[model samples]
Target: MTDQAVADDGPGSTGGRLTTRETAERLGVKPETVYAYVSRGQLSSSRAPGGRGSTFDAAEVDALARRTGRREQPAPAGELTFRTGITLIGDDRYYFRGVDAVELAGRHTYEEVAEWLWTGELRPGVRFTAPHEALAAARRAVGALPSHCGSTDRLRVAVVAAAAADPLRFDLSREAVLGGARSLIPTMAAALPPAGGEAADSEDTSAGLARQLWPKLTARPADEASLAVLDTALALLIDHDLAASTLAARVAASARAHPYAVVSAGLGVLEGPLHGAASGPAHRMLTEVVERGGAAPVVADHLRAGRRVPGLGHRLYSGEDPRAAALFDLLAQVPQAAPALAAARDVVATTARHTPLHANVDLALAALSVATGMGAEAGETVFAISRTAGWIAHALEEYGERPLRMRPSGHYTGPRPPQPLPDATEAPSQ
Candidate 1:
């Protein structure tokens, strides 16, 4: 292939065809950096209707070179047209398509919120076609992961693995980006695979729907109350201001790292006990407390250690997490939620007496999920799975505001370079 053809073939390159690596080399940076450029919409490339990779119009690259002082910075293939003026924090109580996050969290299902962000419609009546093929494949990918892994693990591994599998992960086309996100749902379901196990192909939407998450856990069918509770929980946990995990996700997105990688970064960050993994521990503590007949006492004991309770407070939100209030309200509606709910409250009050910090949503959801039979370990997974909606949204945001690059500001903690060694040791021997 000509150099142009090769450039066109590079991931997301639109002109004559430069492979991402080739484009990066031409631009003088790492392959990952090329993705950041593309993600930021800095680089321009076109997707062939039915082609292997995006083809860049070489002329466009030259135009970009002139625009950004290419000699100084080889901007990636796709660069953002506008600075992401959209700062998520305190801009609103919530948002859905520049709307409200809390409102969507309460009113929308995971699918609906996703549809809203994926398109402007809060409930997309098919303004855009659903990527059924990609959805099916995502389901297969999730189902293919280790069935025994917790939902969080499965969700993480599945998204990462699936991205690795995508042929157009770097394609800059809007439809392609949306299409990739569509896969996360079924992939998540596939990863969960229920306690009894998910079939190779669960064709029914109801079967694969997010609500069905519970049936795989308990022997009983999911009641409307519980499903509603689950939906609300999923929604409330959807997105936060770009958190550390969110930043990690954006880092992956900056690379034009496939959505899978973005989610993987999320799942990985979720692995940290301070973030996504915090819910798992919170749930476990509550359960152990309940089992030991000392929920409050135990929390008080932990408090003496100068540790804030996990899932109780946050850096943001001076008000009760609206997400928590919404979920706790939903939890109240659950038929099974009575005593477990009571136990959680008792624990919360006892802990709060010793500490001014309050119970965050994670605490309530963890208790509620365990009460509902989702299991403590599943809390993080559920959080991972549910937060995926937000993750996808955030990932798209990164897609829009990308080329999220980082520069090191290292501390010179280590010793300086040593002075040159003296002459031959043979002199000492002599």
Candidate 2:
């Protein structure tokens, strides 16, 4: 076929065509692998009408690219490890900026803790008040979503809108970025649709970040103890070392993506089941225990079905997750939360009798959700909100480092090559 025919058959044409080098780069392989693909009949190529080389169908190359991309081996050992001065997880404990997270949770507001993480100083009287125009833009953005959408969905929309509205969102200097984050957290919380469509108590800007978020999570009146639980949960969750979402945010920031874009990247990663959504199942599990009046049957059913129990263990912690233990300890003191506390304890005891696994932070968040009558997905919402501090901190850290340093080199492991294609006269008909 002539070059004209190849063009006619390309992507915009009947089928797209790629040169040998383009095809190899698309597949992340050597040029030799392109020949092997042709020999194995995995890819079809046509001789250039007047030239000696071959051209491939762009669509076919794309299909093969997707297949081989999935089969690519995991990154080599130690390749995934990186250094960070953010949260540290070891010895079943978590620390943010060298201070015990549990200790910080007990005394500090989420805003204060977040400030410390971002700047290494626990500055008091930190306010996350959003500018009127930014808040208005974010509210309009959240209002555009469907009524049944969860808080995280609303948050994602609000972040995008806020980014577009802010003229200075691209300012990556530490002070400007930190100022943007400060405004973002409260705007996002205020922008969430008030639970049950009741207007939020806007009169109280003096309330803590958790207080601002409470009415959005549920319509129930805020109890001091319950608000305390949420406040502590927020502080505790402010950061963790290189979580999947944080890593994604850092990667985006490494490329000099703006603060809003960096956070949007993190929220996208957190939407996955294995990450932020893990608490939804854990909440359901605890609810079942409450309804069934015993933990044994629910525990047995989950085990018998070969399903991993949600919220039971952490890969990094050998004993209880310190965050979980601390949250649960506070929940124990809330008289109004006695039922949830009882159910959580029963589940813990029953699970421990059967397996070595102990409760993790997901379980604590779930228990908090159930205990407070928050929405089923409230745990993830709280997680996404609280972790924004960590994501921004990691983004700032990454911005100071070399750009695009997270790019990984791939090692190809495909079919051997050096095979010859059939001669033009002997080649099969199209």
What does the lDDT read for residue 9 in candidate 1? 54
Local error of candidate 2 at 19, Å?
55
Q: Model 1 off-target regions past 4 Å? A: 1-87, 96-98, 124-149, 197-203, 206-208, 216-219, 292-294, 304-307, 402-404, 418-430
- Tens digits of per-residue lDDT, candidate 1, 246-278, equal 777777887787777777887888777787777
TM-score for each candidate, following the candidate numbering: 0.70, 0.78
Give me the candidate number with maximum TM-score. Answer: 2
lDDT of 2 by residue, 236-294 (tens): 98888888998899889989999999999999999898999898998998889899998
lDDT of 1 at 317: 68
Best by lDDT: 2
For each candidate, the alpha-carbon lDDT, in order, equals 0.63, 0.83
